[model samples]
Target: MFRKEYTRIESSTQHSSVNEFVVINIPEEDVEPKQIILDPDDQPMWESAKIVAPTPNSAIIQLDVDDNFVINSTHLKMILENKFDGYLRADPHDHIREFLAICDMFKYGEMHSEVVKLLIFPFFLCDKAKTWFNELNEESIISWEQMRRAFINRFFPPSLFNRLLLEIRNFSQNICESLTEDWLRLKNMLQKCHGHSLAKGVIIQIF
Candidate 1:
């Protein structure tokens, strides 16, 4: 039989070599989390900062308008005459279409059509619409398409868009209404929806 031997390990705390030792007291610090304050000027591009901060020199929209390119006062007057005041009954899509129709009549001297639209669009807003336009982020709108899309998205939200779409999808002709009247009504609904993806064949089939 082989003899087994066991080796015991001693704890360093129980068998400390040096009898002398120093315990320097370290005071525990009561640290509090720092509250960071951000200046509005530091966050110029932030939407909330833009809204609350005063920016007198900054324009909400940045246009590619040349300093020398001046719009005719008469044209502006004409546009302002038919200003769209955002109200309960006002259809944003109809307003935009009407505005475009009016703008089509004028040709500014050497200025791009897009520039003309951008310059004249602001004059076309009044009352609630004008207020909404004024509240846009500084230099947010750069192009006519951007302005148009933003305008439509703001005024004609997804809820209104879906309602219009549903109306088209479930269109019903009144029992006593003439076919011509019903057709005109359906056409008007289509116009309001603006970008409904229903095929022409399906639309004719709906009729």
Candidate 2:
């Protein structure tokens, strides 16, 4: 092996009292494979550089922005075609948080990876939420039941209603360890979120 192993070191000493570091050294077989495994998972791990809507109407930032946050009106109109449904279209809460972090970094020129978790978990499963869920993961949101219910709700036709309900109920039971309120919130939130088809279209089509 050209490189014997990959090493990771983590440290925290900002308080000026003490510093801490954790390093993981993994045996690497091939440079290419190691790089593949480390290339941000071929997913959106929100970086300030990835913020495409610089002043809006420029490029696309993966997360949706809405009542919780506002993008430049020009960009909003460009993407949504001026017929914004409402705050219901508010960029998903977690997404807004990530973008705001990027905005902060842009304004202040600081980097915060604290929410990188917010950018990774959703795309942890690629079948749903399409490919953009991880643009930000400041909040590590994992409500398997919510995801299950959402999947069934979107993919299950009326014919599978009973099975869908059963699956949801079972998911709720398994995830009871989390507070009922949080799970319900996630379920309700997912219930309100539009399906992945919301914005995947040619920009010119909307314009």
Candidate 3:
């Protein structure tokens, strides 16, 4: 009976060791959690994750929902720590352009859904724009590209784009402007009109 009890106790110990709970020690300060992205060349790409357990020299992270992993703490970086509010406030009417630039910065960061959630919140969007974003189906915006297209369609209406094109066509240099200054001004207008790839000959003719 003693031997049997010892065997059972040993088995329980082994079982507990297999599924041990690890405690994450995040700092008391309002530090944003560090985001982790797997190596691009790695097979079976891992989802972006945030450090939940800040153990010394290492971190415990949860990938998506159930996959918990251990990684060196140094591997993570804080990209969104200071940029979110500045970018949101930079262009009240042109959210799409700012959103695209943000997406580019965090492309491989693996925080697409988290970033999108922040963007759609009332605090980030303007009063008039909030209603339109609120009505969107959350599940449909799984990727950054999908989110980008939605913003573009809503903000950049067909009439607005047409007006911009007309402005480009009717644009002319100001009186007393130097040749170089005029050329630069025309190029700037072309870019704003979304003619980034307009031919040099067309630009010359406009000049």
The lDDT leader among the candidates is 1
Candidate 1: residue 161 Cα off by (Å): 1.4
Model 2, runs deviating above 4 Å = 1-124, 127-142, 159-207
> Residue 185: error of model 3 in Å?
2.1
- For the record, the alpha-carbon RMSD of candidate 2 to the native fold, in angstroms, is 23.3
lDDT of 3: 0.44
lDDT of 1 at 174: 97
1-207 per-residue lDDT for model 2 (tens digits): 444333332322222111232223344555522311122232235532645663422111243323344233433233333221213233343343443344344321123232222222233233234332333233333343343344334444454445434443344333455565656754653443434232424212322
TM-score pick, better of 2 and 3: 3
In model 3, the Cα lDDT at residue 21 comes to: 28
Residue range with the least summed lDDT across 10 consecutive positions in model 3: 3-12
- In candidate 3, which residue ranges exceed 4 Å CA deviation? 1-124, 195-197
Considering TM-score, where higher is better, how would the candidates rank from best to worst? 1, 3, 2
Evaluated at residue 43, the lDDT of candidate 2 is 27
Give the winner by TM-score: 1
Candidate 1 lDDT, 115-175, residue by residue in tens? 8888789889999988888878777777878888888888888898899999898999999
Better model by TM-score, 1 or 3? 1
Local distance difference test scores for all models: 0.72, 0.34, 0.44
